[model samples]
Target: MNIGFSAKTKAFYDLDEKAVYIQNASWSEDVKSISEVLWLNHCGQPPKGKIRGADEHGMPCWIDAPEPTEQERIAEAVNIRNAMLMTADTEIRQLKIIEEICALTSEETQRLMSWKKYLADVYRIEPGNVSSIRWPDVPV
Candidate 1:
């Protein structure tokens, strides 16, 4: 829920053209839109796809509404990394529950293992090796 607010922006890519537009502010006074900002990016021309964007010096730069600073971009990446790690932690906790179930008696194992054979028997299909069960596709 991190929200960034910005009213001041410096265009990293496009610099040449804004000077001209601002010089003629009396003639044209339309505040720059995201598309316009990109169209006026650093190389002094609009991108090929207009909205899709351009690859400037091997960087996958896009037509952001307002491009963030390097620090902000790094923070965003860190947030995503932390979220993934939290998901991994939760999965590992659930896996311990399965591990506990695996430490069962031989009779329990046989009874549980036969459940698969019971399923295939109900389907009237021959159950092969317990370690490797390939489900047949279709009504057959």
Candidate 2:
């Protein structure tokens, strides 16, 4: 499929089928079919965490996405860890209730211990280094 870009709409499209292929775009009268070779030369879509922009010649190009600051990374890490914790909340509470009411079977005891360790591991995870953080496995 041939790729095209509409400067008027600032959108990319599949020219052969006359349909927008990237970004929220509609068929525009100013759509110009970009050379497939040129598009390929520009490496098509930008890599993850990057954005599509224009080169010095105004041709489509890739640009680096802004890096998050340390504080932002820490916040993101906390958000992810909180989400993981939420998933275990109900199970942990149920196990605690069971333990309070009666003696737990060996299997239940093991499961509770595993979940507790998982929670501890998650809690001990430091922020601002989320990329290298190893997430604890979820209980089966």
Candidate 1: stretches off by over 4 Å: 1-64, 103-140
Candidate that scores best on lDDT: 2
Query: What is the TM-score of candidate 1?
Result: 0.29
Q: Any idea how many clashes model 2 has?
A: 0
Q: For each candidate, what TM-score against the reference?
A: 0.29, 0.51
Give me the runs in candidate 2 sitting further than 4 Å from their true place. 1-46, 94-104, 126-137
lDDT for residue 92 in candidate 2, whole number 0-100: 84
lDDT, residue 25, candidate 1: 56
Residue 98, model 1: Cα distance from true site in angstroms? 2.0
Enumerate residue pairs that collide in model 2. none
The TM-score of predicted model 2 comes to: 0.51
Tell me the tens digit of each residue's lDDT in model 1 across 74-117.
Answer: 56655544554454445444444554877656754554445434
**5 Cα displacement, candidate 1 (Å):** 17
Give lDDT per model, in order: 0.41, 0.75
